[model samples]
Target: MKPVSRRTLDWIYSVLLLAVVLLSWGYVIYASTVAAQRQLRKEYPDKIFG
Candidate 1:
């Protein structure tokens, strides 16, 4: 059996970390936007803007 190269491993690790961070940030942003919208709706009743 052959051992994996360090450079390749490093690249894969970096890509995986980047994907995780991006997904987490995307979720956070989505949640924040939803919360903001909800707050706005609560603060302003009878307003059709969202």
Candidate 2:
């Protein structure tokens, strides 16, 4: 097998960084939505419906 080139390594690193950023953003949004739901439930305990 041949040695990997610097450019290829850079590309792989960039893709990994992008994936991490996107995943973090998604997690933040999901967490915020969950927090909002919890707050809503707390403020309106009797109004939650399935």
Candidate 3:
């Protein structure tokens, strides 16, 4: 088997890093939204939408 070239390795590293950053960002937003909803529900248990 042949070793990967430096340029190919750089590209792969860049893509992986970008994917991690994007997924982390997306997860933060999703988690915050869910947390907010939970808080709202707790604060307003009698509300229908909550």
Candidate 4:
């Protein structure tokens, strides 16, 4: 079989790596938002729900 092309492999690797990094960052951002919301709820319990 012919050897894999470096350009193609590089592109694939970069895309997958970028996807992973973006997903990780997304999770971090979502978690922080959730934590902030919880904190706000605690701090303004009546104003928010009343």
- Kindly list the per-residue Cα lDDT of model 2 for residues 1-50, writing each as its tens digit: 99999999999999999999999999999999999999989999999744
* Candidate ordering by TM-score (highest first): 2, 1, 3, 4
- For all predicted structures, in order, the TM-scores are 0.86, 0.88, 0.83, 0.81
State residue 34's C-alpha deviation in candidate 1, in Å: 0.2
Q: lDDT, candidate 2, residue 38?
A: 90
Return the number of clashes found in candidate 1: 0
* Residue-wise C-alpha lDDT for candidate 1, range 1-50, written one tens digit per residue: 79999999999999999999999999999999999888888999778764
The lDDT of model 1 is 0.93
Comparing 1 and 4 on lDDT, the stronger one: 1
Task: Name the TM-score of candidate 1.
Answer: 0.86
Q: What is the C-alpha RMSD of each candidate to the true structure, in Å?
A: 1.4, 1.5, 1.5, 2.5
* Model 3 alpha-carbon drift over 4 Å, by segment: none
Give residue 17's lDDT in candidate 1 (0 to 100).
100
What would the per-residue lDDT of candidate 3 be over residues 1-47, giving only the tens digit for each residue? 89999999999999999999999999999999999988888999987
Error of 3 at 21 (Å): 0.6
- Please provide the root mean square deviation of candidate 2 (C-alpha atoms, Å): 1.5
Residue range 12-32, candidate 4, lDDT tens digits: 999999999999999999999
